[model samples]
Target: MAPQPKHKNIVQILTPVVLFSFFSSSLAEIFFEERFEDGWQSRWVSSDWKRNEGKAGSFKHTAVKWPGDPDDKGDDCFRHFAISAKIPEFSNKNRTLVLQYSIRLEQDIECGGDYIKLLSGFVNQKKFGGDTPYSLMLGPDICGSQTKKLHVILSYQGQNYPIKKDLQCETDKLTHFYTFILRPDATYSVLIDGRERDSGSMYTDWEILPSCKIKAVDAKKPADWDDREYIEDPNEVKPEGYDSIQREILDPKAKELDNWDEEEDGIWRPPKVPNPAYKGPWKRKKIKNPNYKGKWKIPWIDNPEFEDDPDLYVLKPIKYVGIEIWQVKGGSIYDNILLCDDPAYAKQVVDEVFANREPEKEAFEEAEKVRKAKEEEDAQRAREEGEKRRRERDYDRRHRDRDCYRDRYKRHRRGYSDDDYHVS
Candidate 1:
């Protein structure tokens, strides 16, 4: 029997189906299998197993339950296992060396101990077996140490931060999810049950790939003492540098002046009135009073020769002082707009304030004058130097012109002598 050609739509559908099936099978081979009784399978391998530096034995044989329970009855146990493969998904220029494993904890125990540990963060195959890497335990057991705590650790540039804490660990009968996203910057973060922890900034800095800023936990801490820890992503922090800001100038308008009040003890107090009559423009006028038109003596003016003494006639110094103090305390808007209502009053206060500090103002003014004089001197020196250069250039050009004329005259004399010899 002859075979029939497949339909175009059927080929298209089958192509994707076959591709998806192949992809799923390949991923299944790479990822650890989830078996209930067996715990989690390992998807990685260590090269230093032969040297006895790592957990020695077969991949599955070395996978033992925590607290050395062979029955696997503990809350934490390995579920699956595999030899490590070069994970292209998690590998790049910013290489993050990580060992991931699946762990199952039965219930919230007094102390949680099931943690996917990373012994070393380097791919130096020989270093793992050497004395250097063996001497240091690369990671810490965060969840196993604290009750009801699920901890995820992220290490970047030799520094470590716990990505997750189970102070508020949620308990459910179903599977509890804990996954980490490792970036090329050697920084990582964890998500539990699809929700991120409050300390998510660690992941942000790692993902953002920012330069690390190492700050002392406490600014005033001693070199030997441990600083009180604070929540901050070192990578996201501003680097130490300098910045400039524009300065603000005070406003030109403000307010002053009000009627004198004696009832209030702390209020304005008018100066004592002089014994002599207060004189004004009206007092000097020749207009006669209604009662005594013919007589020059006015009732309001007891003494015609009265010359007002400001010390006795003016308002008390305390009254003016009170107004200035009020304006200063009234804030920018009140001080600039309300208190400066009368230009005359504002100018008077300013003059009085500056009059008392005339020496300091004069000294500043003298310094500014000196600075101006120095600048003028520098400009004059520059002009003189430029003029000198110009004069030297002009003199050289004149000398060159004279030399050219002398050379031409010598050449003409030689030519005339040669012509005469030829003629002879």
Candidate 2:
């Protein structure tokens, strides 16, 4: 069968969702999103990454599960290197900031980033690079053990800080929906495949949260405070012969060999073993400490820098949405990026996109497995056929040699000249 085109009919698969987005809820405004359905190349600014890394670079569009080798420059799929698009401006002030996207890590990621960043500063469309500043970076950042986590970094006051809780990301070679929602009440939630995995108040979860309360300026630990809860007994003492007993003794089972000679052969000695009755580092028994107080702590006072703005949940103006990444082996297909202010609507987007994807994924995996199995079977059959042909050739050669030897022997034994066997 002739191979099918790499990119085909992806927009048809997402037509329903794309049509629905036009009729999406009026309250929730979708500032930016990309399904990469058709002609998505016009939307994004593709970097000329071929000059630098002559080996692997570029992102392509394809409907199939496997897009084929990325190094093939002639393949229809090697479209762009990195993902970075110019999006419209939108503000999350007093509204929920929902950032969601679909990503498939289709490559064997040894040590690289499989994450996306949402940049907000004044970005040069053609000059976006790895060092370009971004406001929020979310998704799995995989390297060695030094960094392996679902990195959630939110920039506040020109400083970037990570979320306090450890959010583990999906590392499997499959498509996953990552949704990050920062609500108007300073609370944030992250969902994978439409299931909530991590959620908390951004004020408490991120170090960017300004301290509303602070320690008192003159606070100090009282000098008379006693924090110890246990003390040694006053009358405890060691026994008279405690020090004389050895901590280890010779094992009775380890008998000296009978052939031992002290002068010439050197005598064998029994191996020393731990003494069963030995106790290590004897100390006085602990007693309840009287007049003991709890651990000392300083009182907190109001922080002058903190002004309760009832709108801590409100984020700054979001101008553009982009995927700033530094992937090592780059075959990460990113699509269906929906930015809105409604949780239910965002979830609706997820449901619409991945509604039947679960079943499709299963079928896709099964097909791949079958393809591999068939390939192995074909390879084995070819090997067996080659071996059979080799054996037949060997048999023919042996029979030919036997016939030539018989003819030569018969000619020599009959006393005829060797030339008589030839017709000429």
Q: Which candidate leads the pack in lDDT? A: 2
What residue runs in model 1 are displaced by over 4 Å at the alpha carbon? Answer: 1-102, 118-146, 157-159, 163-168, 171-173, 182-189, 197-199, 203-424
lDDT of 1 at 8: 10
- Residue-level lDDT of model 1, residues 1-424, one tens digit each, is 4332221100000000011122223322221211113322232334343333222222222221121112222111111111222222211233322222222222333222333333333444322321212101111122333335544544343444443334344432122334444333334444443344433344233222332333333345334443323323334533233122213322324222364344654544334333222222222223323333232221232233443332211111110000000010101000000111122232332233223234434543565588789999999999999999999999999999999999999998877655577843
| Candidate 1 TM-score versus the reference | 0.25
Residue by residue across 52-112, what tens digits does model 2's lDDT show?
A: 4342244433344532221111112231234467677667887888888876665555455
The window of 10 residues in a row where model 1 has the poorest summed lDDT is 8-17
Error of 2 at 106 (Å): 2.5
Report, for every candidate in turn, its global Cα lDDT versus the true structure: 0.30, 0.68
Q: What is the TM-score of each candidate against the true structure?
A: 0.25, 0.60
